[model samples]
Target: MPIWVTEWALIDWFAGPDYPDSARQGEYAEASAAMMEELSIVERYAWFSLPYWDHIPSLGLYHPGPVATPAGEAYARAGG
Candidate 1:
């Protein structure tokens, strides 16, 4: 048998300049309650991705502390 793991990121890179990419993503996450609710079909290890210690761009869920990123909030609300 084999096992698979996955993580997702809600990027807002295309949002207007007024909002930073992460901020835009946070806004989306606050509004993706429904979408988050529907992402409970994880048959294996599935979760949201976030920054990490030392600012390394790796598959992580924390960036030195409690991350309130839109995507993270959504993932938490959605039972991730």
Candidate 2:
């Protein structure tokens, strides 16, 4: 069976034009890219739009049903 993975954009809460410079945004992007590359499932990634007040981007990871691991099994059972 093929494996599937998901990713989300994690933005910096303190990031803003008036705020001091920071690498938080870059770090998030890098981490997300690294995970996708490591899993070799970049296409499976999904990201939700950030709300006006929320800076973090919501992400979801989904794989085939009947997962082998307990966590995956639980997620599948939960219909996630």
Candidate 3:
């Protein structure tokens, strides 16, 4: 059974009220790099489930709801 981490949970954990919108603004470079290393380490031996493939927008991302977000921006850039 794959335990998928929900986008809502990630946003709540990383982009929470405690985290200033500006402060956590980045690709989270170090963390992303570590994840790559960890993924390579556990590619064969299972340790934990992978994260959700798609990302969801936070409350801030949508002003009134269902608006533009960086995720949406990236998606558009990708010709999504």
Candidate 4:
């Protein structure tokens, strides 16, 4: 028998100036939820690529310290 694993990212890098809004609007979350719902039928799992992706200058990866973003809230509500 064999097992399969996968990972995915939800950021819209090509959104350019609207990247922030794109990330916060739950669009990615909705997509993730839909994918997960489909995967659920197959008993598969999905991993979020990054929880906190912001990189600060000279400070390295930025950790918001357990804060929840609007997208995160929507994701949870979507059963993600």
Candidate 5:
């Protein structure tokens, strides 16, 4: 089964500093996609921008939810 990892801290870390908003977001998506492809375990993966306090901004990862499929089962087994 494939494993899905969501690290909000990592997103915050990467989104910090001199990087342009578009570039940072683009890199985040590209990296996540590449990771999924490399693992060959994920059926789907997604990321979204969210508003943070003081306009800091944040990102979120949403899988197919808690009852989707093999991915859901794996997620549950992994204590998602």
Candidate 6:
């Protein structure tokens, strides 16, 4: 199974909260698509399963709840 875990403090250390939302979305889309593509390949084919996504929005990490982020949308498209 694939999973994406996010730690706010770790992200803050590398890139402050000031990081552009657009840039983050772009990166999220790229990452989500890459993961999906990898999982879709015959060489990498495996049982399909919804990716486990963990992030605490209260702590600043993106949440795939009420509001869907690019990552969440991509995951949905991948049949999550």
> Which candidate achieves the best lDDT against the true structure?
1
Predicted candidate 5 versus true structure: per-residue lDDT over 24-60, tens digit per residue: 5445555545556667776554333322223332222
| Two-way TM-score contest, 3 vs 4, winner | 4
Candidate 4 Cα misplacement greater than 4 A, ranges: 1-5, 11-25, 39-41, 56-63
Q: After superposition, how far is residue 80 of candidate 6 from its true place, in Å?
A: 3.4
Q: Write one digit per residue (lDDT tens) for candidate 4, span 1-80.
A: 33334554344557652333534445665676666666634345444433555641111112267555555655567664
User: Candidate 6, residues 2-76: lDDT per residue as tens digits?
Assistant: 554322111344544433353464355556555656663322322212232443232222344455555445444
TM-score of each: 0.40, 0.31, 0.29, 0.46, 0.37, 0.33
Candidate 5 lDDT: 0.39
lDDT tens digits by residue: candidate 3, 13-80 = 54453332312422332233345445534332221112212332232322234454443333233332
**Candidate 6: segments with Cα more than 4 A from true spot:** 1-12, 16-23, 39-65
Give residue 20's lDDT in candidate 2 (0 to 100): 16
Supply the global lDDT for candidate 1: 0.49
Better of 1 and 4 by lDDT: 1
Per-candidate alpha-carbon RMSD to the true structure: 6.2, 13.5, 9.0, 5.8, 9.8, 8.0
List model 1 lDDT by residue over 1-80, tens digit each.
44434554453346641333555555555555455454555245455455552542333444566655555665566655
Output the number of the TM-score-best candidate: 4
Q: What lDDT score goes with residue 25 in model 4?
A: 47
The C-alpha local distance difference test score for the whole of candidate 2 amounts to 0.36
Against the true structure, candidate 3 reaches a TM-score of: 0.29
TM-score of decoy 4: 0.46
Worst 10-residue lDDT window for candidate 3 reads: 44-53
- What TM-score would candidate 5 get against the native? 0.37
lDDT of 3 at 75: 29
Weakest 10 consecutive residues of candidate 5 by summed lDDT: 58-67
Local distance difference test values of all predictions, in order: 0.49, 0.36, 0.31, 0.48, 0.39, 0.40
**How many pairs of residues collide in each model?**
1, 0, 0, 0, 0, 0
lDDT-superior candidate, 4 or 6: 4
